[model samples]
Target chain A: MTTSREIRLKSRPVGVPTADNFELASVELPPPGDGEIQVKNLYMSVDPYMRGRMTDRKSYVPPFELGKALQGGAVGEVTASNDPDFKVGDIVSSMFGWREAYNANPRALAAAGPMGGIMKLSTHGMPPQAFLGVAGMPGMTAYAGLLRVAALKEGDIVFVSAAAGAVGSVVCQIAKIKGHTVIGSAGGPEKVAFLKEIGVDHVIDYKATPDVTAELAKVAPKGIDVYFENVGGVHLEAALNAARPFGRFALCGMISQYNETGRPTGPANIIQAVGKSLRLEGFIVSNHYDLFPAFVRDMADWINSGKLTWKETVVEGVDRAPEAFIKLFSGENLGKMLVKL
Target chain B: MTTSREIRLKSRPVGVPTADNFELASVELPPPGDGEIQVKNLYMSVDPYMRGRMTDRKSYVPPFELGKALQGGAVGEVTASNDPDFKVGDIVSSMFGWREAYNANPRALAAAGPMGGIMKLSTHGMPPQAFLGVAGMPGMTAYAGLLRVAALKEGDIVFVSAAAGAVGSVVCQIAKIKGHTVIGSAGGPEKVAFLKEIGVDHVIDYKATPDVTAELAKVAPKGIDVYFENVGGVHLEAALNAARPFGRFALCGMISQYNETGRPTGPANIIQAVGKSLRLEGFIVSNHYDLFPAFVRDMADWINSGKLTWKETVVEGVDRAPEAFIKLFSGENLGKMLVKL
Candidate 1:
């Protein structure tokens, strides 16, 4: 048996999660059996989506079991291997997160479906943690949601909320690279500046502007052709009002409303969808695994050419996983939030 | 010169439209010029969407101008043709409505764009009036919203609100034809009976059931793959509740909240969209004209095979246009509502 430390969900949160909601515990792990691999995790990803898994409700993904290690994306190195396809020292990524070491038989996990597959990472001389950030889920999300979901086109004016975060940053950059005018909304001047540096044509500092819709209207005077909805409520309403006829909205995530105590008020003006002939579609990226290889190819090219940039605010140690996750809701993290093992 | 009778918008209605908002007038029309043709109207369509045109809001389609003739789909016969394309006695469908006679230049109208294209009808061995309903805008709405907007698969079980109405009726039939189980929700026992006659697998009398979500869960215990939204609010919430993972919602209209003075609470449970990975897309049939030919071909085959049945609630005289339009919200119309002139 091997001793491994992990983060566990002690309790579900009522509103914004507190430190008490999570617990750090040491667990015992067995050695890799036949056809299995043992991994020593290098990094654990703490994302907004993990919050949903903490809630005890039936959703697209199952709720994280209480007192069990919270699962998420992790990049690791194989310490022991029994599978012929994998070897020791091979870098890989899997959804078995918040733990220091694990023994996994991938073929056995595959029976659980799409959520189970372990991906072998080709870093191409980049840091392993980069696989947990822009070169990973966030990057693929922006690409698939834009091209595949919204059906974005050239000359289209795109609006992105949470514009400096992981997915939003990539959305704005891709929209610009594809010959579309991009508008971004971030909470502060620092994020606003980052958006500008990345070539967003228009930027709105939503924290400074009490009325985001009015600010958006000023920046995007002609109206937006596509809206990438990352924040719900006011942000969604602003996008709806600013969307032109036949606008398409790719519903990625609604981070702002995730921890609300009661049912948050939806965009009151969603009826505008009817008047504008809007297509608002919500998608989970796991369903679109077929697009991953193409995404990685294009993203790697962009990074190599210095046309793309990635940001991360990483907290060290498994004990601090709760703090890192809590910081996401607080909006203190600059971009993708990660916890190091 | 010919004296033509038309229905004009006197004033915008506050809540539900009344006779005070409508005015019948006689206008003199000049002779058809070089390329123009004069048409004598036989049938005019009054639909729920026209209600949006009555208001002063800037929408996908322009609002109705006060003291001007209300425009919508109309089927008529050409009385005089100066253009080689159209001859006298030819049946044609145009978006110039509530008028007994209209002089139109086909080329000039087509240049104005998709909305202005006047389609000459072959009657396809069906009644010319069918062009305004099952075989025209509403029929196309169902076809496009189902196949294109929803991206429905063969095994998809579809839930349709306003199931006995024009668009909803066709949506149910098409879903059934595609080998999908269909659940239809209508306001009364009569409408419920009609849905049953149309081969809807399950029927919900929404008026009798206070909790539509419960009713839907009872009927569609396994959950639905697609929801064809006609009446919004409660129906949308119910569909959201009854939706399986990765369900598609083709949001055609929101007849229930159309006349609200204030912003009606938009499906309080819209957050369910994120959990379910639901796609809620609102589309105007006009934007999907590219699929019209295929839709017409399929619909013609269905009609010829006696697999498709169409019902029309026609009110006599152009003076009763407002009454016909008002009847739509009252749930009195059995199917496609029309006014005969």
Candidate 2:
């Protein structure tokens, strides 16, 4: 038997979660059964969607049960394999996150599923941790959202909220590469600088601007054609006002109001969609995972050519995973927030 | 010179429009110019969407400017003609309404463009008044919103708000015709009775039900698969609660919110879309006019076979057009409301 340290959901969170909501424990793992493998985690992803699982609501993904080990995206090395398919040294990614070690059935591993948000880590001349950040879900989200949902047109002006964050960063970069003018909004000077360095035509430091909608209108005078929605609330309202007639919104997440106690008031200007014929659609990365092959291949080529760049805010240890997740709400971390085990 | 009485926007209304907001005027009309024909108005439409045009705001259709004739869908006869293509006694429809008579260029009558929304009236064994309701924009809205936008599957459990209204009534009947069970909600006992007569599986008298969401939950225990949103605000909140995962919302209009002084707090539970992976798309019938030929054929067949039936609330004379349009917000008009000139 092997002992592994793991974090589990202690209780359902009411609004904002605290350390008391998660319980750390030791679990004794039995030998890997037939067609099963044991993995020693190298890096784990702490994402916004994980916050939804902490609550007892019926969402696209199941809520984390009390006293049970929590799961998400994790990249690890195979330590022990009963099946010949999964060798001891093969690098793999699974939905069995929040743990230092895990035993999983090889059958549950695929490119897209509840257990396999993505299965094998396509190294693609990148670091193993890259599978949890830029080269993985966040990266694919931006690719599919822009190309498929927003329907990026040539010479189109695009606006992205949370431009310094994981998904937003990639979205802004891809829009620029596709010959579309890009406008990005971030919370601070460093993030704004990062956006500028990445070739964004215009950047808005939302922290410095009192009226984001007015500022967006000023910069995107011709009006935004595409808006990648990461943060909701004020961002949606701003997008609504800035977007021209027939603009498309690729809505992936709404991190801003995930922890609200009462019902979150949506954009006051949602009615604008009716007037402008704006198409606002919410999507999960799982729905577009079929594009993974093309995404990974294109992303690898882009990285090698120095056309794509990324950042990771790593929190060292499985014990600090909860803290890393909380930091996502406070906007403390830059780029993709990850936990290095 | 010919004289015509017309209704025009006096000033933008603060909240609910009153008689004071509209001006009754008589205009002197010149003879029909080259390529133009004179039309004697017979049946004019007073639709809920016309309320949106009353506001001095940019929309899919231009606002009804102050001190001008308010234009909408009107079917009339060519009393006088200068164009060779148009002959005397030819029945036609144009974007001329809220008046007794007018002279318009024949180019404005087409199947599809800015001028295309106003088509040459096609009465297929149905009354000319039928062209204003069941065989016109309202009917096409119901057909396209279901078959295209909402993507209604064979067994979809449809929930339509304002189900006794023009578009909603057609939406409910179409859902039933496609082998789906339906629940419809409308104000007062008369509208509810009308819905039941039209083969709705269940009907809710919304006026009597204080908690619409709770009432919806009771009727649609299995949950709704498609929501045709004609009324926004409380109805939208109820639909959000009743909708199942992956449900689609065809947001054609929001009549409940057309007359608000301040911002109307939209569906408080709109974030439910994110969780349910629900898709909400607002649309105008003009965008899908290609479906008109198919729509008219199928609708005429349905009406002839008695598989479909319709009702219209007629407020006679062009003088009462404003009062007829106001009836939409008050929910006084049951089926397609019209003004007989």
Candidate 3:
């Protein structure tokens, strides 16, 4: 028998999540039987989108149930395998995260679905944890939203909110590699420096700036053609104000509104959309997994050429996973926030 | 020489415009010069979009110049012609509205551009005044916005605001003719009855309805697939509230917020766009005139089949044109509002 430690939802959160909402529990597992594989998780990811799952409301994905182990992206090595497709010591990624180890049927893991599905990673000279960060769902999100959803064109100026986050960092690099001028907005001097390090043409430290709209106007005098929205509210209003005619905004995530208890006020200048002929479209990365092959190929090339890079704020051990998640809402993480199991 | 009475912008409006913002003047016109046509306008249009032009700000179209005649859609009879393309008694439409008569080079009238450009009408048993309303810019707006901008599909239910107005009434009929259930919102008993007369599946008298969002939900229990947005503020918030996944909104205008002195509050639930994966696209009718051929042909067939109808509120003389325009904000017009000279 093998014993594993896991975190389960003790109670749903009212506003911002607290460590008390999660409880550490341990379970004993018998030897893998039938088509099951045993995995020992090495690393797991915490993202802003998971906040929606905690709420008991109908959305694109189902809400997380109380008294159940929470799920997310995780990389692990197969400790044992009864399935012929995977052998012992093979590294794999799965949605069975927030836990230290588990035994699962291969078919069930595969059925975790897009962005949450299981996959075997070759690593290709990179760390297995890279699958939970840059080379994974967050990476694919940046690629699809900018290239496909926003329909980025030559000479189009790109603006990204939350520019120091996992998805936004990749978006910044992709726009640079494609030879377009990029503008990014983030909080604090550290994130501002990181944005500049990634070759962002213009950077706005929203923490220091009193009015983001005026700051954006001063930087993008000619106006932006594409807006990659990660933070909503004021950022959205600023984008609307600075957008040129026929501008396109890819609504990926709105982390700013994720923790709000009440309905938040939206952009007051949204009416500018009509006068300027803007298009704002919301999308989930899972919906565009059809571009996986192209995304993987392009990311591999960029990584090999040293054109793509990422940063992470890691917390050690499974017991601290909830704290890492809470840090995300506070802007305490510089880039991707991960828990090392 | 012939005398013409014209209305000019006397002052820019601070908020909601009053009669003092406009002025009436007389101008003398000589016989038609070379390549020129002299026209006596029979009917002039008073539309909601003109509100934008009255403000001194950059928009899709240039703002109306102060101390000059305000321009809009008008149908007139040619009194004299120096060009072979037109003859006396031939009916023509031009953008030189707010004036009873004018002599202009045919090329200048043709260069009025897109929705404001000049066109000689065949009439084809329809009244010449139809060129300024049902058969002109407003009809084209409803056509392109619904079919192309919103990309209406079969079995998709539609919700339209300002369903008793010029462009919106056409949108209602088109949805009905295409065999889709349509829910429309208008003010007053007369406007509500007009919506039913045009075969709208559900009609909400917004003046009597205290909660538009709740009323919309009661009528469209399955949620709306396509939203034709004309009235903004409350209607926009309600549409965002009841939108199903992948719903599309074609934003044509926002008459509700146009006269506001300060920044008005936007939809508090705009963040719902991200969760529902909705698309909101704003458009100007002039941008889609390439669909004019299809729109004109389809409109003719619909009219001949007796499946299409319209209403107009007319005020005699150019002196009352400003009053007619102001009545639009109060929801006093059932459908198209016009001024006769």
Candidate 4:
């Protein structure tokens, strides 16, 4: 028998989640059952949407239960396997909980689920951690949400919020590849610089900028055609005012309002959507699972051709998973926030 | 030379248009030239969109010139024609100004402009006035806006505001014909009764029911799947709250804000759209002109089969056009508001 370290939800959070909401414990790992794989967890993702799951309200996906291991997308090495499909030493990404080690049913680790939880990584010329960051769910989200939902066309101007985060980073790159002029908003100078390095046409440090709409107007004088919405509230309002007639907004997440005590105030200029004849659609990456194979092929091709780039902020220990998750809300992570056990 | 009575824009108004903002002038009609047709106007349409054209600001279409005749969809008789395609006594519709009579280039009066503003009427099996109402722009708006833009599917629950108005009246009928459960909101008890008589599955009188959201909740407990938006502001807010996850909203018009003093206060709960992954799209019926042939066929079939019904509130004499136009803002007209010359 071996000890496995795990982080479980101690209590539901009211506003932003804290360390008090999580309890770390060490439990004895049981032997792998038939058609199961015992894996040593290597990395776990700490995403902004995890904050929504900590609450007790009904949402697109279910809320996390108290005293249960918090589940997220994780990449690990299989130490033991009773299933023929997976073997010892085989590295795979799975919907494994936040833990140091665990035995998972092979059936549960099949492919991407309905809520867009997990998927196996294609071992091309990319880092294994990329599976948890840009080349994984976040990458697929930016691709499908911007291309399929927003119907981004060549020469269109794009504005991405939370610009240097996992999803936004990929969104900027994808927009550039599609021959669109891209402007992004980040919270700090370093992230803004990173965005510039990745070929973003323009970057704005939202923290230092007093007026977002004015800044956006200066960068995109012709007006934005596509707005990849990740941060809501003020960012949404700015995008709305800066958008041209017949603009399209692809809403993937609302990180700013995820942990609010009550309903967060939306953009004040939403009426502009009507006058401009705008198209605004909200979507989840999981809803497009049917297109995963196609996404993987295209993304891998971009990576191999030196057109795609990715970054990850890795936290070392499983015991520190809660802290890493909390850092996502504070905008501390530059790109994807992950825990390496 | 014949004297033509015309209504011209005197100045741009701040809020509700007044008599002082318009000038009724008696001008001499120009003689028809080669390829020109002299139109003796018989009827003129007064629509909510005319308010937008009254402003100097650019919109979907250009703003109406301050000193020029206010153009609208009008049906008239060809008193004289120098064009090979037209003849005397031939009734036709064109984007003619608010005038008793005028001479226009036949090329300018060809089929219809970009937004399908005018079309020759077929006065078969219907009243001649029906060509300006149900078989005209409002009817096509309902058909294309609901079916093409909203992508209405069978069994979907639809909610429409300003249900007794021209566009909304047709929208409910189209949704019903597609096998959808249709609910509508009108201003008074009389309008509510009219909505029910036209085969709307449910009706809510917004005046008697102070809480529109709660009223919608009682009828659409599963929440609305599609919202055909006509009245904006508070009504838009109610629809946003009552919309289900992945719901679609087609924003065709916003009559509520047309006469507002400034930027009207919009829906307070728009953040719900992000959480529910809803899709809200604003479109002009003219954008889907390629689908008009199909729309005319479908509408004609429904009308002839007794599956579709229509109503009109006709105000006689072209002099009453301004009064009829003002009544749209007050929600005083049921179905289409037309003025006969």
Candidate 5:
């Protein structure tokens, strides 16, 4: 038997989740049984969407149950394998995070569901942790949202909220690489600098700005054609206000309103959507797995050509996973917030 | 010479428009110039969307200018014509309403942008005024919004706001004709009865319901698949609250917020859009004239087969057009409100 440290949900959060809402625990796992593969997790992702799962409500992803090991995007190395599909030392990705190591049947892990199933990772000279960040769900989310949901067309001026975060960074870089003028909005000066470094044409420091809508209007005088929505509330209102006729908004996440105890007011200018013929579509990255092959191909080309880049804010150990997640709400992380085990 | 009595914008209304905001004026027009046609107005449409144009602001359609005749859908007979395309006594439709008679250059009338261009009406055993109501802009709006924008699919349970109004009534009947269960929402008992008379599966009197969201959830226990958003504010919020996963909202109009002095608060539960993967798209009927051929065909078939029916609240004369327009906001009209000249 092998003992692994894992974090479990101690209690459901009402508004903002605290460290007390989670508890680290030890789980004893027997050696890999028949058709089982043991994985030692290297890096675990802490995403804003996970906040939705912490609440006791039905959503696209099921609510995280109390007293269970929380699940998320994790990249792990195969330590022991009784299955032919996965071999020792092979890097694999699974929806089984919040743990240092786990021994499970390949069949059970395959049925783990939501996001990608258990699959061996092809590093392609990229770091294994990259799968959890830039080359993973967040990256795919930006790609599918911009290309499919938003139906990005030629000469589309794209505006992205949370431009320094995991999904937004990728969205910014992708829009830039596609030769479209990109406007990125982030909370702090550091994020603003990061957005400028990523070749964004216009960077709005939302924290510093008095009126986001005014700032956006000033920057994109002609109005934006596409809005990659990450933060909701004010950002959504700003996007609506700055959007040109027939602008499309990809409603990826609303991190700003996730922790509100009371129901958050939607964009006051949402009525503008009618006169402008705006299409606001919400999407899950999991629903867009079909775009993976194309995404991977484009990403590989961009990565090889040194046109694409990323950042990671790593928190060491599974014990600090909750801390890393909480930091996401405070806008502490510049890019992908990850727990390095 | 022809003397025409027309309604002109005296002053922009601060809130809901009133008779004081409008002034009846007389204009004398000479006989048809080269390529000009003289028209005698029969009926003019008074639609909710005209309220948007009344405001002096940049929008999809240009704002209605002050000290000018208010432009809208009107069916007229060409009394005199110098244009070879138009003959005497030929019925025509143009954006030349709120007046009794006028002489317009065929080129200028053809260039009269927004909605449908100037065209002769076939009438097809339907009333000539039906071209301005069910078979014209409102009817086509319902068809295009439902089939194309909302992408109404198999087994879609549709919910329509302003269900007894011109556009909404057509939407209710079209959905029913296509064999989809539809829930129609309208204010007042009269509108509710009108909805029921049109084969609407479920009728919701928004005036009587204290909580539209709860009422919607009650009626659609299994949840709604599509929402035709004609009335915004609380109706939009209710739709968001009651929408099922992957539900689509065709945002046609927002009459509830048209006259608001302050910026209207959007749906508080708009975040549910992301979790539910809902799509809310705003569209103008003018952009969808490409669907008109199919729309006219479908409407003709439905009208001929007696599968589709409509009602109109006709206010007599050009002078009463302002009163007819104001009645839309008060929900006094059971269906399409028109000005019979």
Candidate 6:
């Protein structure tokens, strides 16, 4: 019998989840039923938003149930298939659980499902790990949130927080491709340098800057036209103050306060959003599932043409997944933090 | 020479203006020049935004200069005219000053000028004072801010704060006309009653409701889709919490904290905006000048068809203009407040 190692939620976490909140165990893997495929996990993504799912509160998506395997975006290779569409050796990405190996029901992970069931990975120049970072959920998020929700235009100035992270990094690159002047904020000088190397016009080390608004103003003399919000609290307040009249703010994530026990202090200059006629919108990448094919095509073209570059911070083993996820909050990862089993 | 009583700004106040800030004096009304028109001011509008003009700081419009006549949206009768477009005994509205009588450079308020100046008013179907309130800047503000900026649609739920005030009252009425479920919050029971009489689906007296967000929850079980923001502070905070996912907020004014010495306390749960994917936009009516003609037509139709209602709290005499303007901040006036000369 095949065996799979799974990470299950032990309890609802109060604050930054400790290792005690999760339990790793091995279980017997069931043989694939008709129209199903057995997937051997390759890479498991660790994102900030997964922290929200750890709680039992009502959110855009349901919370993770205790004693259940923690689920997230994952890329795997099909080892066995009863379905004609997916053959052995075929690589695919799905919103599967944190498991070393499992049988994936074609219907459950199929592209026709509401939860954006599994899809075949593009056989382009980009690596399969890019499916979890750029050209995946994060890349689609930057595209939809910036171009669709934020309504970004050429010559607009963009300010992206958490610039070295998965989503923010792609947002900066997409904004640049659209002919926008891009400025980014990251936790350290190295990530800031990385952002600058990847076509970001300016980079602000948020840790080094005492006054975020002032630092943003110094970089964007004409003022920020588009603020791609990822880290909330002080960053959001600073963005509000620095935003020009009629600016557009894309509310993507709030990594700064995600691991807190209670609600974090929100922006203090929110009234400025009203006076300046700013547009702030929050969105989920799943809402734009219709655009995935279009996104993959464009992203592949960009990657082939040497227009877009991506980096992955891969944790070597499955046992390090929890540690890698926790490190995201501490700003330890330079790019997309993933666990390779 | 014809004698006219005029009120001018004697000095700029640091915070709230006292009687000493304004000077009432008699001035000689000169005869109309080549293209000038002599207007006998019948009613002078007193609006909250005039307070912003009292400060030396630059805003959407320039501040009212010290020792100069305080200009506002006013309606008057043309006693004499040298321009062919305007005739004697014609009642018109313009950005005239707080005066009993004055001569206007007809070219300054003409529909089409060398520099794209003000448009002349047509007093065909309703009260002349309507030109300053429901059919003027405030009316256009409610129309454009809601329709264009907020992208308000039929069947959407709406919430308006300071519901009995000039802009809010008009906003509620306009939303109702567009087939929206309208709820409003006002400072007193009387204003709440007025809001209901004007077709608001629900009314909350903010003075009585200690937790405005809780009160909003009871009334708006589905949560608000379009929020016409006028009074900021706790009300804004409540609105943010009560807004549904993908809701849109049109930030028009913040009367609640306008007089505060420093930056007003912003919304505490602004991070919720990211989760809900809400859209908040700040706007000025002056920026939407192109929508004026369409606004005038729709407002006139509503008025003539008895589909819309309005209230005017007229404070007689030009000397009472300052007190009338101050009453807006206190929520003492119902609907549009005007000072009759």
* TM-score per model over all chains: 0.92, 0.95, 0.98, 0.93, 0.98, 0.95
Model 3 CA deviation exceeding 4 Å by range = A109-115, B109-115
Which stretches of model 4 miss by more than 4 angstroms? A108-122, B108-119, B266-268, B316-319
Clashing pairs in 6: A109-A118, A277-B282, A282-B277
DockQ, all candidates in order? 0.54, 0.54, 0.82, 0.47, 0.84, 0.62
**Candidate 2 residues A1-341, lDDT tens each?**
88888899999878888999998999999988887898999999999888998888777777889999899889999999987778888999888889999887777564244546336665867899888777888999899988988888887899999888999999998888888899999998888888999999999888899988999999999899899988888888899888887788888888888898998886766667766777777677888888988998888888899999998899999999999988898787789999999
Name the runs in model 5 displaced over 4 angstroms. Answer: A111-116, B111-117
lDDT of 2 at A15: 84
Q: Supply candidate 4's per-residue lDDT for A128.
A: 74
The alpha-carbon deviation from the true structure for residue B10 of candidate 3, after best TM-score superposition, in angstroms, is: 1.0
Q: Please give, for residues B246-321, the per-residue lDDT of candidate 2 as tens digits.
A: 8888888887788877877766666677667677777778888888779978998899999998989999977788
Candidate 1: Cα lDDT at A4: 88
| Docking level of model 3 | high
- Residues A116-156 of candidate 5 have per-residue lDDT tens digits of 47889899999999998889988999899999999988999
Model 4 steric clash pairs: none
How far out, in Å, is residue A82 in model 1? Answer: 5.5
lDDT of 5 by residue, B211-322 (tens): 8988999999989999999988889998998889999999999888899998787888899888888999999998998999999999999999999999999999999999
Error of 4 at A203 (Å): 1.3
Error of 1 at B101 (Å): 3.4
- Evaluated at residue B84, the lDDT of candidate 6 is 86
Candidate 3 lDDT over B1-341, as tens digits, reads 99999999999987788899999999999999999999999999999999999999878889999999999989999999998988999999988899999887777656765455557898889998887778988999999999999999998999999999999999999999999999999998899988998999999898899999999999999999999999988899999988999999999988898898987888888878888889999998888889999999999999988999999889999999998988888888878999999
TM-score of candidate 5 relative to the true fold? 0.98
Question: In candidate 6, what are the lDDT values of residues B19-55, reduced to their tens digit?
Answer: 8899988889879888888888888888887888888
Native contact recovery (fnat) for each candidate is 0.59, 0.42, 0.79, 0.51, 0.88, 0.73
**Residue A299 displacement (Å), model 4:** 2.4
Candidates 4 and 6, the one with greater DockQ: 6
